[model samples]
Target: MTFSIPNLLSLFRLATAPLLALVFLVPENQNIANIAATALFLLAASTDFWDGFIARRINQSTSLGALLDLLADKLLIVTALLLLLDAERAPVGACIFIVGRELLMSALREWVAQNGKSSTVRVIAVGKWKTGLQMTAVPFLFYAGDLWALNTLAVGVWLLWAAAALSVWSMLSYCLALWRNE
Candidate 1:
C-alpha cells in the first residue's frame, strides 16, 4: 500500500491501459490516434522493465509492489489485445489463445498462492519470452502501418502469433512445474 516509486510506475501503466482504448475513440483523427496509442503503449511497457529493476536496485520491493506490477502488466496487455482485435489488426484466433491462456494462468497462480506453493508458478523463462514478445507486438499492432521501411502490422501479427504460441508453451511449463511440486 505504500506509494513507492515502483508502485507509482505500476499505477501509471494501469492508468494508461484505459487511455489507450480511449485514444482509438478519436473518430476523425485515426492516424493521430494510432501514433498516440503506440507511443503510450511503448511508454507503459518500458515501465514494466523499469519498475522491477528499480524495485530491486533501490531495495523497495514489496509484496504489494509485486502484485501491482503483475496486475498492471496483465491489464495493459489485455487492453491492447482487445484494442487490436477490435481494429482487426489482430487475428481472432490468436487473441482467443492469448487471452484464454492469460485467464487460465492467472487463476493457476492464485490457486498456487492459496496452496502456499507460489514459487512453483513463479515466472519462467518461457513466460518471460511470451511477455517480451507480447509487449513488442502490441505497439506495432497499435500503429497498424509502416514504420520507415517495415510493414508494422504484418510484423506485429507475426509477433503476436509467436507470443500466443509461447503463451500456451509457458502455461504448460507452469502446469508441469506445479504438478512436479505437488
Candidate 2:
C-alpha cells in the first residue's frame, strides 16, 4: 500500500499526539512540557491544512486519508481541551460548550449521511475563524500559569470567549444548512 506524503504526515501527527499528552502530563517539567506541547499542537494543526492542500493538488485524496485527517483533528483538539481543563486554565463551561458543538456537528453529519444525503460538510469561513481562535487560545491557556505575563492569560480567555461565540454560530449554520437541505 503506497501512502502519499500528506497521508504520512497525518499519520505522524496522530502518532505524536499521545507523546504530546504524556509530555504535558509530566509535572516536573511544566514549562518545557507546555512549550513542547504547544509546538507539537501547532505542527499537527498546520498539517491539517497542508494535508488537504497536498491531497487536492496531487490527486491523492482517499477515504482513508480523509478519515485519518478528521480523526487527527479530533484527537488534537480533544487532547488539548483535556489538558487545558486539567491545568484549570480554561473555564469549564467554555470547554463543555466546545466539546458539545463538536459532538453535535458530528452527529448532524452522521444523520445527514444516514438519510442518503450528500456528505459534503462544507467548512464555513466562520468555522475556520473559530478553529484559528481555538488553536491560539488552547496553547496560550496551557502556558497561562507559567512565567508569562498575566496579560497572556487574559488575552487567551478573551480569545476563548470569541471561539465559543464562533462555535455556536457555526453549529447553528450547520443546523440551518441541514434543515434547508431537507
Candidate 3:
C-alpha cells in the first residue's frame, strides 16, 4: 500500500501504542518516563483525529487507510488501558469491560463486512464520544498525580466512568441495529 500522508499519521499512531506500553517497562526516572509516555499518547491521539480529517480533505481515503486508522485507535486505547491496569491506576472491572466491548465490536464489524453491511454496525456518536472521553482521560491517568491543586487522577477516573457508560450505550445501539438488520 502506498503510504500517503494520512496513512503515515495512522502508522505513527499505531507505532506509538507499543512505545506507550513499554515506557513502564523502563524503571529509571519513573516520573519523567510517565510524562514522556503521556506526551506520546497525546501525540498519537492527535494523529487519530487528524488522519481522518486529512484523508477526507486530500481525497486520499483508502480501504487500507481506514483499516489502519481503526487498528491504530484500538491499539492505542487498549495499550494505554493495559498499562494503567498494570500500574494499578485504573479499575479492573472498567478496564475489562472496555477491552471486552472493543473485542466484541471488532467481531461484529467483521460479521457486518461478511454480510456486506459495512459501517452499518460501526460505532455511533455516543461511541465516538466515549472514545473522546477515553482519549482525554487516559493521558490524565497516565500522568496520575496532581498538577497544582487539581487532582488529575480523580478527574480522569470520573471521566473514565462516564466514558464507560457511553460505551455500553453505543454497544447496545450497534447490537440493536444489527439485530433489526439495519
Candidate 4:
C-alpha cells in the first residue's frame, strides 16, 4: 500500500471519473457539461500513461498502483460509455458489446490467474491500440464539435468501432494464449 506519486496520479484519475460523469449527467449543466467532461476525461486518460511511466522510472510500481490504474480506466470509460448511450450519441448495441466484452475478459483473466496461468494473458499490442482509439474517441464524442465541416461525432463513432474491433481481437488473442498454455 505504498502511496507513491504514480499511485497518486491513479487516485486523481479515479477521482475524476465520477466528476466527469456528473458533468454530463447533471441536467442543470447541460450547456457547458460536454466541454468540461471532455477536459476532465482527457486529463485523466493522459495520467494513465504518465503514472505507468513514472512508476517504472522511479521503481515505484506496486500491485496496488496497477490495480488502481486499471480500476480508474474502467470507471472512466464505463462512465463515458453510459453517458454516451443515454444521450444517444453512441449506439446502445455497440456500448453493450464493448461492456460485455470487458466483463468477459475480466472474468477470463481471473480464471487464468486462479489456474496459475496469469502470465499467459499478457497485454497485446492490439489492446494498446484499442485503448488509444478508445481514449481518442471518447473525448471527441464528448466535445461533439465540428471542425472544417467534419463532424466529431461521426469520426468518434468510427473510432469507437475500430477500437471495439481491436478490443475483441485482443481479447481473443489473450484467450487463445491461455488456452494454448493449458
* Candidate lDDT values, in order: 0.92, 0.80, 0.86, 0.85
Residue 101's C-alpha lDDT in candidate 4? 75
TM-score of every prediction relative to native: 0.97, 0.89, 0.95, 0.95
RMSD, candidate 3, Å? 1.3
Worst 10 residues of 3 by lDDT: 21-30
lDDT score, candidate 1: 0.92
Global fold similarity of model 2 (TM-score)? 0.89
What are the RMSD figures for all models against the true structure? 0.9, 2.1, 1.3, 1.3
Which stretches of model 2 miss by more than 4 angstroms? 145-150
Candidate 4 residues lying further than 4 Å off, grouped into runs, are 27-29
Q: After aligning candidate 4 to the native by TM-score, how far in Å is the CA of 73 from where it should be?
A: 1.0
TM-score: model 1 vs. ground truth: 0.97
Number of the top candidate by TM-score? Answer: 1
Better of 2 and 4 by lDDT: 4
Please write out the lDDT profile of model 3 over residues 65-159, one tens digit for every residue. Answer: 98999899999999998888888788877777788889999999998999898867765789889899999999889888788997888888888
TM-score of 4: 0.95
Q: Return the clash pairs for model 4, or none.
A: none
Clashing pairs in 3: none
Q: Give the lDDT of residue 94 in candidate 2.
A: 81
